[model samples]
Every structure is written in structure tokens, then in C-alpha cells.
Target: MSTLSADLAHQPGPETVAEGLLTMLAVVPVCLLVAGYGRGVQELWARRGAGQIVPPWRVAAFGVGVLTVLAAEQGPAHELAESSFAGHMTQHMLFLLVAGPLLAAGGAGLPLTLAAPVPLRRLLARWRVTPAVRRLRRPTTYALLAGGGQSIVLWFWHLPEPYTAAVDHPVTHTAEHLCFLAAAWSFWAPVLGPPRHRAPAPVAVLALVGTMLPASALGAVLTLAPAPVYPARVFGADPLADQQLAGLLMWAPMDLVVLVVTLTVFLRWLRQLDRDRPAGLPRTATLPGTAAVPASAATEGERR
Candidate 1:
């Protein structure tokens, strides 16, 4: 405790809160622009009686995701993250695991594309089927790029040198966050995004579980390690405690999120299977301990 207190006492003063506030200023305008543009597109398409280009619920979902991001990035957490490892972890988890998924689930891609100008739209349409995109659209690619990539990035930046550098250098920190967010969005595509290119629920489920492995391992290692790897000495808390908190933050929340949503995915999977089944196939219960048998087989049973 004394060692921790001593470290805290030597801390430097914070930059003006205005720095965080300035970021908030940027976030608000961008969110408004997105929402307004989406609404405008929806209205334009609706007026033509051509149906909506972007659904209202999706825009609302996207707005929610954006607002959640702003709260994580520009709120006190952003400032505290600079000083406290736990705070930093909270921000990262919120952005990469929570808000990013919400944004993807909202299918912001559709609205953003629809909102683009005609020239850009034509370019995008041409690019949609390009070989590079087709390759990236593969389910295995989503698992590798999003699930594997995010895990690697999360672990890589937490290494002692990288952690120290990000804490010490603003640009490095920004890059770290951008990398995290990008990887996270990529990872979530199978589950939430590029809706037209959805991976099978089973595959998406496996990817989600596989993605949890590295992050959980890293968290466990950090939680059990003898010393802190982060540059938390100048911060106002015990580095050891802070590191443990950060580890727990990394370990539990994402897995819980996956667990809850995987259940939803499973139910959806069952429903999807039911829909895709041949017309007379017997439906299976989504819950365990139920078997599906052919209705015709049952109907013609002669005790055989």
C-alpha cells in the first residue's frame, strides 16, 4: 500500500478536461451527421414509394452504438484510462466488444452506403463483387480476421513495451485503439454485420468461442502474474491491483456477452433450421433433449 501511495503521490497533473471535451465535440457532430443523413435517405426513398433505403430501427440501433462509444471514449473513462490501467481496459472493452458489435448488428454498412453520393455508390457496387471482397467475405476469413486478429491485437498491445509506449505516446495510443476497434468490427462481421454475408450460426458461434480463448488466457495470466506489465507506476493506485482489475475486466465481460448472445444465436439458428427444413419435416425443440423425426415416418409407423 505504501509503495502504491508513493507512486500515486508523484503523479503529474492532468491536461485540461478541455482535451476530452474537444473530442466530445467531434463525436457529437459526427453522430448527428450520420443520423441526419440516414434519415434523409430514408425519407427520400420513402417519398418515391420505393420503400426505405435505411430502416428507422437500424438507424436507432446505430445511434445507440455511437452514443455508447462516445460515452466510453469521451467521458471520464478516456481521461482516467490514461492514468489507470483498469480505466483503459474498460474503455477498450466497451469499444471493441460492446459498442462495435452493436454498430455492426445495426448494419450501419447499409445506411452508410445508401447515404453515399451516386458516383461513390457506383464505385461501391462495382467493388462489391471484386475478387478481394469475395475473398474477404468467406466465413473462414471472417473467423481468422475478426476473431483471430482481434485476439492478437489485444494481446500484442498489452505486452510490456507496447503497453508502456501506448501510455507514453498519444499517437501510439490512438493507433492502438483504432486497431482494436477495426479488429473487433472485423471479428463481429460473422455475428452482426455485412448482413447479406452472414456465416452459419454454428460457425459464427464457434468463432465467438474461439475468439474468447486468447483474451481470456491473457487476462488470466495478467491476473495471476507477480508484477504489473503496464506503466501504472505514476498512477494513483497499486499497479498490481490495477492490473488485476484490468484482467478481470478483459476476462469476464466479453465472455458473458458472448454467452448471452450465443443463446440468442442458437435460438435463431434453430428457427432458421426450422425454416430451411423440407415442408413436412418435424420441428425440433430449441432446448436440449429433443430429437427431430420425419413427420411422414411417424405417420406411416407400423411398429417398425
Candidate 2:
């Protein structure tokens, strides 16, 4: 026991202690979410049996999302982000594209609902039908609000004035991350979240495509700039090169991520359409050696 204690315990400096505390703070929300989800899963398992509430893939996606957030906010990535424009862009992309969508698709909303107290759940149900809530829930309203919100947040934070402030200050930096994550989550929820909260696939597609325009434009501006926009945050000896690389990172990877997600949503929508179709309602039939029979002809034959 003494040997174990000695081996396990070591003196940590102030910087190490602060980093540990910040890491712990980052972990708190994830832990709370997991706990709530676990409780909900337990109840669901009792009522509906195992693996019926949330799909395995969704659970895996949530885990990956959590990992992505930790990686972006906590260790080497965070360190790199402090000094490098490209690294910061990489972290932001992970938050926006990977973590946000994956978490939304993980279907945690229902689980969290299930985890809430009965009184709170009842309150939420009542609130759901309120005018303000209904308006916010509208597909078009949410799509526009979400996309617009994310675009504004992204552009504002990337501006040299605000970006420099964020880099220089801890509180501003924290706020920047929160803004990015919240905007991203809002932008994706209607497309990827619980089915009850989701919007039509067409609407989601349009929202995503619209968002891409501004994002790509920003990236293009950075890539084509004559000099470094963020001189203090440059990592490499060639600041211009670093900024250009950062811009390219945002351009290519973000666009690819959006395209992939759009395709996934479209295909899933197609699948849902096929699934909801009436069974055994054939409009035409063809025998091995015969031409297809039209529905009208078949109906006429039946009438005769």
C-alpha cells in the first residue's frame, strides 16, 4: 500500500494543476450527459428490452463525439491551437463538423428527456406547444436561424480583432468555444437529432448548402490574402504560408464533411420514403414473357 501510494502520488506545479482543473471542467458536462443517458438506457432496457432505444452506431457516434471534443480542447491539439492558425482551424472543424453532427445524431435528446424528473418532463411537454416554442420548432424557422447563427458566430470570431482577443484571454477563449459548439449544435440538430425534432431532409439539405457558401467564402479570403491576418498566432516561420494552410484546411475538409453529411441525410430520407410506402400496392406487374400491365388496365379487367 505504501509503495502504491508513493508511486501514484506526485507533486504537480501550478500550471499542471490549472490544466488538470480545466480538463476536469471539460469532463463534467460529458459525465453528466453520460449519466443521464445511462439512466435512460436502464429504464428503456427494462421496458423495451436491450438495443431497442438507441442504435449501436448512434452510441458509438456519441462516444466518438466526446472523444473529439476532448482531443480538440485538451492536450496536444489545444497546445497547437494556442500557437498555430492551422491547428486552431483544425480544432474548430472538429467541433463543427465531426463532434456536433455526431452528437446530434447520437439521439441524446430523448434519453435526456427520459432521465429528467417527471415534473420537469411535464413542464417541457407543456412548453413544447407554446407559441414561441412552436415557432422555433418550425422547419424553415429553425433552418434559417441555425444556419445564420453559425455563420455569424464563425465570421465574428474569425475576425482579427475578436480572434486576437480570444487568443489573448482565457474567458474570451472559453466563450468562443461555447459559441462555436452551441452554434454548431443548433445548426445540426434539426438535421441529425431525434426524429421527433428533425426537419424534412430537403430543408436540411438546403440549409447545409446555404451555409457552405459563407464558409467557403471565408476560407477563400484567407487563402488569397496577401499577408498573415493573424500575426501573433502564427506557428511556422512563414506566417502567410501558415495562414494559407489553415484556410485550405477549413475549405477542403469542411466542404467534404458537409457533402458527406448531406448525402447521408438524403439517402436516409429516400429509405424512409420507401419504408413508409404502402405494402403490396403494386401499380404494375410483368410476367417473364409479358409486358408490364398498367394499373388502369388491371382495374378495368377486375371490373369486367
Candidate 3:
């Protein structure tokens, strides 16, 4: 045990004690910001006579999720950063999949939009209706940015030196997280809807599922591999277990979120279609003799 302690001491930068302090500094502010901003929005909306339409519980959950992530990455959880690949995976998963979705679900984006100054909101509204926004509104663009970008960042950061180096450098570490969060937000944008841009439900669903595949495969591969893929262990502590945990976190929970979001988008679309259909039209099929039936229908029926 003494020797193990000595080795852990020699392993890299500061001791866990100092790292924990730094971690708190980073995470606490983020949690407070999210929570405070959410509250402010609710207050603002209430003043406008919107009531408590935005679910306070969801906002609270989102703030909690962010806090949970911060705690995991910084506090007692800082050991995970130094420990194994699996631990790192857990951190990434929580940040990207769990916390990210909760934040988005809390209506953070829209509320922030609402919270902006009236002039800014007007500008945003105008921009939203513009041709440029229309082009970007496509589900394909959201999928590519959210799913494809995330996959790329995940794989790129896993490269041995870079991964280790990121932990040592604050900027890179922050950037890594920002990438994950951004990707998650983009991927989920379509499902949650009211996007500055919009797309058909089917298309958004396809994009969500399609983007998830590569990330899932990557996680599976990492989880099953016997040896650690990163060299951080050479100078640091155990890497194998951390890597595995990271993989599992990436694969399971993230996939589940994707599935849930996809179903949500699909169900919402179906409901919209139901609402939009002409009042008298049958829900299941078009009128028999309408243009939908085709011009050759009568001749075919007479011949029969």
C-alpha cells in the first residue's frame, strides 16, 4: 500500500487534493450559471403572463445533471480522471449524453432566446425566418454537425498523447467538453424541436439513428479490447479500467437517449400530421375518387 501510494504520487501533475480544488472551481460556476439562468427565464416569462408553462422540474433536473457531472469530474470523482479509461468514458458519457440531453430538454436554448433583449429576440426571429436559416433548418445539417462532429471529436481526442495532454492543460480540457456538449445539443435539436430551423420528423429520426451508429461501434470496440489504447498509463495510474468504463458509458446510456429522442420526434410528427389533416378526411386513407386515386382507376375497375 505504501509503494502504491508512492507510485500514485509520482504519476503526473498535482495530487488528487489540488486537482479536486481545481475541479470544483470549474464545475460549480457552470452549475450555478445553468440554474440561475433557468430561474431568471422563468421569472421573465411569468412577468409576461406566460405562467409556469415551462416545467420547473425539468429545469431543476437539468441543473442537477450539470452539477452531478461537475461533481463526478472534479470532486471525489477526480480520481477517475487519473485512474482508468473506463472512468474517463464515464465522465464523457455523463457530459455528452446524460447532462447534455437534460440541459437541452430543460428548454435552455429557447429560454435563453427568450431571455435575450427584445432587440436581440427580434433579430433572432428575423434571422430564423430567413433563407439562410431555412437551408440550415434541414435535419441533415443538424445530424451532420451533431452526430458526425461528435464522432470525430471523440475519436480524435482518444489519441494517446492528446488525451493525456488535454487533462494536463485546462484550455484543451475545456475545449474537449465544449465539443461534446455542442455535438449533443446539435444532435438533439431536431427531436426537441422549435429549432431555429426545422425538418420533417422522419428525416430527423433517420439522422439521429444514423449518426449514433459509429459512436456506438467505437464504444463497443473500446470496451472489448483487452489492453488500454492510451499511453497515459505509462506515466499515470491505471488506464485499462477507465477506458472500459468510458466505453460502456458511451455505448449504453447514450444509445438509450438517442432511442428516446427518436421516438419522441416520431410521435410528435404523427400527432402533427393528425392535427393538420383536413377535418373531414379519413385518417387512414385518401378519398377513393380524388386525385390521389389516379386517372387509370375507373378504366381498371370497368375492365375488372
What lDDT does candidate 1 reach at residue 91?
90
Per-model lDDT: 0.74, 0.83, 0.68
Ranking by TM-score: 2, 1, 3
Over the stretch 242-303, how does candidate 2's per-residue lDDT look in tens digits?
A: 89999998889878988988899899989989888788767785668989997778788889
RMSD of 1: 7.8
**Candidate 3 — which residues are off by over 4 angstroms?**
1-32, 50-53, 114-134, 137-140, 193-198, 232-242, 271-290, 294-304
Instruction: Give model 1's clash tally.
Output: 1
Q: For candidate 1, lDDT tens digit of each residue in 20-64? A: 555666567667657655656575666765435445565666778
In order of appearance, the predictions have TM-scores of: 0.77, 0.81, 0.72
Q: How well is each residue in 174-208 modelled by candidate 3, as lDDT tens digits?
A: 66777777676666655553454455677777777
Clashes of each: 1, 0, 10
- Top candidate when judged by TM-score against the true structure: 2
| Candidate 2 vs candidate 3, lDDT winner | 2
lDDT-based ranking: 2, 1, 3
Indicate which candidate wins on lDDT.
2
Off by over 4 Å in 2: 1-21, 233-235, 267-304
